[model samples]
Target: MKDLRLIFRYSKPYLRDLIIAVGLLIIECAFEMIIPVLMSTLIDEGVPAHDMPVILRQGGLMVVCAVLALVTGLLYARFAARYANGFAAELRLAEYAAVQKFDFANLDHFSTASLVTRMTTDATVLLNAVNTGLRPLVRSPVMLFMGLGMAFILSPRLTIIFLVATPILAAMLAWIVSKVAPLYGRQQSAVDHLNSRIQEGLTAIRVIKAFVRGDWENQQFDEVNTELSDASTETFRFAVLNMPSFQTVMYTCIVCIMWFGGNFILTGNMSVGQLTAFLSYVLQVLNSVMMFSGVFLQMTRSLASARRIREVLTEQPDLANADQPVTEIENGAIDFENVSFKYNAGAEKNALSDITLHIPAGATVGIIGGTGSAKTTLVQLIPRLYDATAGTVRVGGRDVRDYDLAALRDAVGIVLQKNLLFSGTIRDNLKWGSPDATDDQIWAACRAARADEFLDRMPDGLDTDLGQGGVNVSGGQKQRLCIARTLLKHPKVLIFDDSTSAVDTATESGIRHALAQLTDVTKLIIAQRISSVQSADLIVILDDGRLHAVGTHAELLAHDTIYQEIYQSQKKGGDPQ
Candidate 1:
């Protein structure tokens, strides 16, 4: 119930439609309740008296009531649908927008598949609850009590039968709901697992085919599929138990009513018309009870989904701008003071340990490290992508945390280790670096990154489409495009985390020469090949999570054992000429 608060908040804007739908529902219920009285009147007086006028008049009124009821019911459905869909759209948008505001740290709690399910599948479930519940949730209690009132008027004795049955049915519904609530939670978990399996299999379909591991992927998929099927079956089986429970009590009540009402008619205590109308009202009352049970069951399932949605909306982003932040960077100089970081709060070991380093405003420095040395982690701190677990990261002599996130990121551009391009034309993807950049600037950036080599051969040039993740281009072309995009930002500080690994040594050297022309901007490069960073003003070698040595390329070759071995290994392997 606490988790359902957001649903009501999103529905605030559609209150008018909801109110109108409820008003129409009340009107329709009134018309339906009136018909049984008219049927009783015609049977008791008009039919027995053989008066055609009474019979015809009563029949005409019933038709009019039903027609009005039908019209109002249809109108109610329209408004309810509008209200539900409108709220659903807003809810999904809120979930998506909340994620956009989340810091990188917040993402550690949610998986890709889980996020997709919460936004799409869980949202749809709540939408269904609104659609199926809109009228029934209100109508059930309204009709039940109203029908009972009318039933007692016809024969109080028969009404007693209803009094005995209602509590038993209510208990049954409560028991069923209690049994199914946890199952619904399990059912949603199963859905998440199934989606995870499908997403993994689809995203890695090419790799699976190349490795001839289709059978293994299929087997993994089957496990999740069976888990989902079993969970859904168990949840729905209990959810649907209310119907049989309602029927069992309903028939017992009807049997008691007929036996007692027959004795009353024989003793001249009740008329045939009253007995017939009484039975009709009993049916209406029990049916409404059953309707309430169904709506209650449906809401239990929706509440499970609502809880999942709340997890996304209620998450507070750990990263935010300072109350009053420095807007402009002074220069490209960077400093890391006793910085240390661990990925999670309870992590046993730091990904990057206490380290202090500095680079001049316009120096080009190279960073080399073994696997799991936190090379990418160190660069991410500069852009404030992930805040350091401890210590101050200064950009342009100001604490990075003191700068506005937007301004800080604008001054620092990084080409991530894993380059990605959205599904769009090359020009559209490039514009992400600078939305308003001119074509000439774009071309210049492309030339600097050597992306022009391929663009010049393709007829589409910048207009060429780069399918999802730039799959239309080779890995080398994709890396170059990413670098070109980052160059368009004209950032004060540039950090490349092995961004040119796919390119050949010749092409990479050409890129480095182009970067050297930006004399005022600072550059930090992380690479596996010594040739890629050998010419830097300073080369920093990392061992584990600590900085092992910092020196010029020649100095490192002579003095640093780790740097010497890496260079020798690379020289043995030879550059990709």
Candidate 2:
């Protein structure tokens, strides 16, 4: 019921149309109900006495009732369609907006594939359910009681036949609902699993092909596909049982009605028209029950989807701006005072432990860390991607939490390890950080990042289409283009998380030299190669998520054993792998 209420809340704007649809549905059903009574009058008085005028009059009334039913049914369909589709569009938008608001911590509770399924397939199920279920939801009970009332009027004893039939069908449907409801949940899970595999395989298709793992990939896909198929088969099998059970009960009641009703007519207790009308009411009563069963099955599936959808809709982000946020960033100075962070609340240990560090405004700082040392995690804090589990991190001499999220993020630019470029022209990817940047400004950033070295050779230059994820460009080119995109933002603080690893040492040096000219910018570079950060004014070495050493390249090599070993390793291998 709570899930149902959530769906209705999203449907609030469309409620007027839904109410209008329900009203028209009731009127259409009322007109349908009157047709049978008109048929009874035509058969009883006109047919028995050969009264042409009575027959014509009753027949004409039946036609008018039929036309009225058709018109109202059409109007009901129009309003129902407007309500259902409008509700679905709004629900999907709300879900997308909710996902956009989720911070890294909140996002950890769900997966990319799981979120995709909830927003798409689950929302689709609800759309279809609402569209198909509206009529039955409104009409079934109305038709049932109205049919029953008219049945009792025609022959009360014969109406007793339905009581036995109704309960038998109801019990069977109740059992089916109980069995199928849980299976629908499992079925949706299977779909999520299948979609996860599909998304991963497609995204990493190049890696799979390079490794010649096509057979292995197929086997993985087959496992999830079969699981989905089996779940769908089992769920629908039980759900479809409703139709068979309804038919058996309905036919049994009809047989009893005919057998007992024929006796009533012969005994002069009922007329032909009355017996015929009673049979018509019996079909309506049982048909109404059938419609209810159909809706019951649909809602069973919809409720499962509703629960998943509501989970996203109701989620509270881990981060929000302070009530009175500091909207301006004064400078690029960053400080971490007694900071500790755990990705999960109940995690056995923190990813980064109690450590303090400070980088002055406009300082070029190099961070070298071993794997899992939380180098990337440290920079992510600047933009409040993930809040610290303990202590405070300050930027521009104020707590990062004090500033509005947009203001803080806009002041800090980060080029991630993975150089992801969307499918568009090279100019589109380059100007992503500053949508309104002039072509000359874009070219200047490109030269600074050494991206112009390749763009000069391409026939289309800036107009060149990069394809999906910049698949058209080489690894080094993609990295350079990504750097250019970030540089275009002209942020106060720039953090490069091993973003230049794809390029050679000389090219990387050129890029660093370009960065050196930005006197007002604070640069934090994380790299595996010692040469990449060897020229920084200050170097910070991290080992196992703790601050191991902070010194210039010469100062570190002279005293720090860890820095000395790293330098020797890179000297022997050209660059540390």
Candidate 3:
């Protein structure tokens, strides 16, 4: 219901169509009730008196009412479907936009598979509820109440027998519903879990085959599939029980009416016409209640889905943009003053700690460390990916928080360790770095990143399509293309987090030579290869989230023990020469 609240808030703007649809529903239900009464009158009054004119008049009126109801019902259903679907489309768009504002930290909270489920499966559930639930729960209830009242008016004494069965049936249905509600919630969660497993398997199929784990993967999938089946079966068992239970109770009530009302008519307590009309109204009420039973079952599942959606919509974003932030950079420099960061607050260890450094404008600095050195985390702060815990990160002489997120990131171009590519053309990917760039600007960027060579060899050149995650390109090609794309942006500061790692030594050297030619831009190169950082004006070494040393290549070899060991190891590995 909470998830439905958010959906309704979004759908509120389209209330006119909904109101009109409800108006039509009332008309349709009214005609439906009137036809039953017309049949009772034709049988007991017209047929008994042998009056052909009375039968014809009542029959003609019933036909006219049916036609009007059918036409209006069709129009109302058409409008309702269009409006509900349109509102769902709008809701999906809004959710997607909200997802875009989420930062890396927020993304980590929800798995990729679960997010897809929320956007597609959960949204569809809510949409169906809006389209169909309104008619059953809202209009059907009114019809039942009106029919019951009319039944009592026709014969209050006979209506008492029908009324006695209602509360017993209601209690039974409520109990079944209570038992099924938790199962539906668990069932939806099981489906999400199954979806995640299947999605992960498909995405990493190559890896699974490479490791010859196909049989194992199949077994794992079977386990999850079986779990989902069990959950669904549990929910369905309860749902299927409702119909038989409702039919038995309704039929019993009908038998009671026939036995008791037949006696009343024989004893001259009620007229034949009144007894017929009362039976007809009781049948109408029974059928309407039956319709609602099925609808209530579906609502149970929808309510579960709505709660799941609410969990996501109500989630407070931890990476919101700073309020009233300044417009642009005030200086072209970066400072990390005694910064320490732990991904999980109050954890025993930090991802980066006791990091103090200054990067003045127009300087080429390099960061080097072992696997857990926090080199990436150190640079991430400069772009405000994660805020520092015990210190401050200042960009342009002010706290990075003080500058607007767009402005701060605009000044920094980052080519991350994991090169990510979208499903688009090479040119489209590059244009993301600089949307307004001309062909000449793109070519110049490619040349500087040493990516133009292979890019030119492709038949379509920059227009060649890259598959999702750049699956169409090799690792080295992907890295160089990303570098070229970043270069096109021409940011004041560039952070290449081991961007050239996948390329050959010769190609890496060529890219480094090109990077050296971009003398105006500040460069922060983070790498494992000793040769990558050897040419930098300044080099900083980190170990176990702490600053190990900071100096030039020659100065580091002379003073820093950690840097000396790494340099010696690379030398023994022969520097890929």
**Residue 444 CA displacement from its true place in model 1, Å:** 1.7
Which residue window of length 10 is worst by lDDT in model 2?
Answer: 568-577
Order by lDDT, highest first: 2, 1, 3
The residue-by-residue lDDT of candidate 1 on 1-577, one tens digit each, is: 8888876698888989999999999999889988889989989999999988999998899999999999999999999999999999999999999999888899989999999999999999999999988788989888988898898788777788888887898789889989999999999999999999999998899999999999999899999999999999998888878888899999998899889999999999998888888888888878888888888998999999999999999999988899999999999999999999888989999988997999999999999999989888888899898999999899999999999999999999899888899998999999999999899999999999999999998779999988887889998999999999999999999999999999987899999999999998899999988888899999988778888899999899999899888888887888522
Off by over 4 Å in 1: none
Clash numbers, per candidate: 0, 0, 0
Q: Which pairs clash in model 3?
A: none
lDDT of 3 at 370: 87
Query: Which prediction has more favorable TM-score, 2 or 3?
Result: 2
Q: Which tens-of-lDDT digit does each residue in 80-188 have in candidate 3?
A: 8867887788777777877777777777778888888878887898788778877776666877788888887778878787668889878878988998999988888
lDDT of each: 0.91, 0.92, 0.84
**Compared to the true structure, candidate 3 yields what TM-score?**
0.96
TM-scores of the models, in the order given: 0.97, 0.97, 0.96
Task: Using TM-score, rank the candidates from best to worst.
Answer: 1, 2, 3
